[model samples]
Target: MTFEDTWKPKIDAYRAKLDEEVGPYKALVEGIDYSSENFNAVEALDTLLTEKDREITNSTAKQLVAKQRDGTLTAVEIYNAFAKRGAIAHIFTNCAMELFFQEGLERAKELDKYREDHNGELVGPFHGLPISLKELMKYGGKVTTAGFVCYLDNYISNSPREESVSIQILRKLGAVFYMRTAQPQSVMHLDTDNAITGRTSNPFNRKISPGGSSGGESAAVAMGSSVFGIGSDIGGSIRVPAAFCGLYGIRPTTKRVSGLGSLSGGAGQESIFSSQGPLTRTIDDLEYYMVNYINMGKPWEYDPNTIPLEWKTGVSLPETVTYGILLTDTLVEPSDAIKRGLAYVQDKLRDYKGKKVDVKVITIDHDLMKEAFKQTLQIYGTSKPVHDKLFAISNEPLLPLTKFFLGFANPEENDILTNNNIKEQFKYYMYYLFKDQGIDFLISPTNPNVGEVPKNLTHWNYSSMFNLIDFPNIIFRTGLTFDPKVDVKGPTNVTDYNANDYVNAPINLQLTALRFEDEKLVEGVKLLDKALELA
Candidate 1:
């Protein structure tokens, strides 16, 4: 059969399966208007819930777990609330690739039974917490699409069902997974879109991107669909979306979280490896997932690439902290909104300096960032062959973003030697730069601009440089947005992509620490988060 003929049935079957899965929840959404242009997922879901249900769905994973353990809320109630809300989020944003609310509800019931049988004992750290999975993570018996139409029929495992190590950890911790979020076709773009699931719009403003390939996760969490969700990043997949969606996300140093059993078009090309981390509305939830995933999950035992490091809790920063402010990376100057957000934080830090926190700012040249951005593209180019093969199988036309990425490196070049040399040299430069400055962490714009309109995202240097150097980075919302009246175009244009008014788009900043300093990065972010009143 022709590839198109073979792929057509698979696509139809996948849609049919989604229809069947969502069938049980149809009645729950009967009163809701899915087609309303005025529909806001967060507002609609909040209105749908009782005051008590709203409180349960809006609580952080840590808060939910505590309530469940104390018998204040049942597992079934928590799961149902999130599941129904998740359905609403999907309706508004097209964020879900798969929905298994019935299965998730059953799992919640089992957890409740365990709690009752054991005198209100909990299953694990994440007991009764409703979490969403990125499309890349493998869930047993579920189709692992990875946003590729070619893999629509590819069930997670053929024999004894297997889940990704991260998913297994979450399941053991009593995380009920009702939905798998969407991603871009190649899982490489900054916005989520694919042949199977279409485009996932920003929940904040439908015109802009939610940020991908983890866009779905950010949108869902931002819309209160899930308390927390897993998102993977090679470039700015996790951080950009988190920033754009007014949420918190971390891109830990590579391999900190297990990638085993996860699907990626860039699989096996480790010039720059992807890392998995949590996307949440609050900073504490980000820490909650990291601490438990490291200490309780024991990732190293399952994934060979994971480093065997215990998660350090109670991380305390010094009384005085130094922050290196990077206004621009040289490749692209940030938009006025982002610049204003940076200045706002800097002003706040200066005000609080020497009293409760010691704050210092060091501005560094962006020559290294320019080189790192170029080299990171070369590293990403190594995965073209893998992507080419996948696309060839389904005879699918390449998306614009895919075409742009594939043109980054010469296919004939031996990427291993060249990319590694570039990485090493960049690392050396950063080591001395941080040493000379004696800064705790470097802060910059997470993206050159706020969230982009779909298909217009091009410059990734702001976040990709850290990926090139393998530093631990986090993106936190600045609690600011673009004011069209105030933020107008400056005389010098810094970006080549089309610029928009960016009305109501969230502005966020990136913070980074040295490699293997993931714990310090989180602690530093918390301090800055407080100073900026980000919570």
Candidate 2:
């Protein structure tokens, strides 16, 4: 009577047939040495971050290009170091789905030759930056199965004659994506767990889950695998992993970037929301990407769906800015670390900046926001129980966690209409949230728990609530993470918002703006990003 009861046998047969042919791949995967890989990977990483931080942070891409012009370092050497680290990262975290190292090296060599020919001068700003990609993105001649069981043999990515639009744009800006990272089955989970590459682990701790479907990108960037990475989001796909892995990421407004030609599991589901953005080490790197990925790529030219808006670099903040502080959404009270982390951030913004920053605490109608967000994620919403049941069929072991999703009834007995109505409420709540707060942006925790145990999933409503509002939100670490002893404190709420279920996690802070007011949100986060020194 369960979802798997009818389809498990069919899906398992398909997986067996595919595995039968991919003998060596299946064999190589069985015995991976994670500890050795993680240890060596982290040791090598410290040096690269140190070098890149000094070179890129001060004057940024503009300065790096200037330094290249002055002959300090060649593009080839930078590309080589990052590529090697990225390879090690794949082994350490199960972060890679496919690779093109040789291809990227060859391109790097060409850039070296170009600089040599001109005595140093070259192309665009990000001429030598190393970037990795999520598997859902298509690059010509790379498989784009995107973790589906049936499409394991799909060669859409291997069609050399056709490259994805994003790939073309990156190449034009002199960016090279030498590898593709992993994703989950439906491309919906906040953690990676698919049939092909399996689940990816957190870079900080291998036992913990990195938020997904963009988890691999966040993990890679966190472990110093790549300088920056591009990932897609719908819900908190970009922010969750960024928060979970302790990195900076932006989920730009849905229409800001190109999602065209990208491989996705649920292609047509857009009512809730979907977007593509960056998971990077530094907020400045994020700016570099947004500026170049917009101005130079000319995404509007390729995808009609993309808004014909260009990056407005000249936009300036007022002499002072006030942030609408949303300490807790009141949906689920954040863990002690989250509360402390936000307080720390609020304090730093006051003392560190010293002057010229105006801050305010704005309480939002939490009951409405929480109720609205909860309604949006019901059984038959964008993430329908039926589709979940279908995807779960491919589950040979039922994923343990998903069994709870099937509910305690036969598939035929589940309520469908009641579910969709809740999903619709998410849209209704957004209309009220912005009207309630006339401030610049809302700040709140991404998850009540920093990083959860592997299969013990609980929170998503924090950011999912914002997703309901269709706000442009981003996540980055404050360099402070979970230390349960220091972070733990008694519950604040006398009722349901009690402290018993909470535990410290690297708290994620969300900066949100009104619909299409992404520029304002980005500016506000950049200030906090600088103050927090998350880079």
Model 2 poorest ten-residue lDDT run: 493-502
Alpha-carbon runs more than 4 Å astray in model 2: 1-44, 47-64, 117-121, 157-162, 379-398, 401-438, 489-506, 533-535
Per residue, candidate 1 scores C-alpha lDDT tens digits across 1-535 of: 4656788777777778777776765676677665543244565566666787688877878789888888888999898788877877887788889988878989999999999999988989988888899988988877898988778777876332367888888888788888899999999998888888678888767778899889999999998888788999999999999988888899999988987888988888878889899999888899989999899989998887799998887777766688888887766667777889889888887886434554466655577566567778888988888888888889876778878877887667646787788788888888788888778888888877787776667888778888887899998877787777767752123434333436667888889999888899988888787777764
| TM-score, per-candidate, Cα-based | 0.94, 0.81
Task: For model 1, name the residue pairs that clash.
Answer: 190-212
Tens-place lDDT digits, model 2, residues 51-95 = 654344333455556666788866776766676566656666778
For each candidate, the alpha-carbon lDDT, in order, equals 0.81, 0.66
| Candidate 1 lDDT score relative to the true structure | 0.81
Best by TM-score: 1
The CA lDDT at 108 in model 2 is: 81
Give candidate 2's whole-model lDDT: 0.66
Cα deviation at 216, candidate 1, in Å, is 1.0
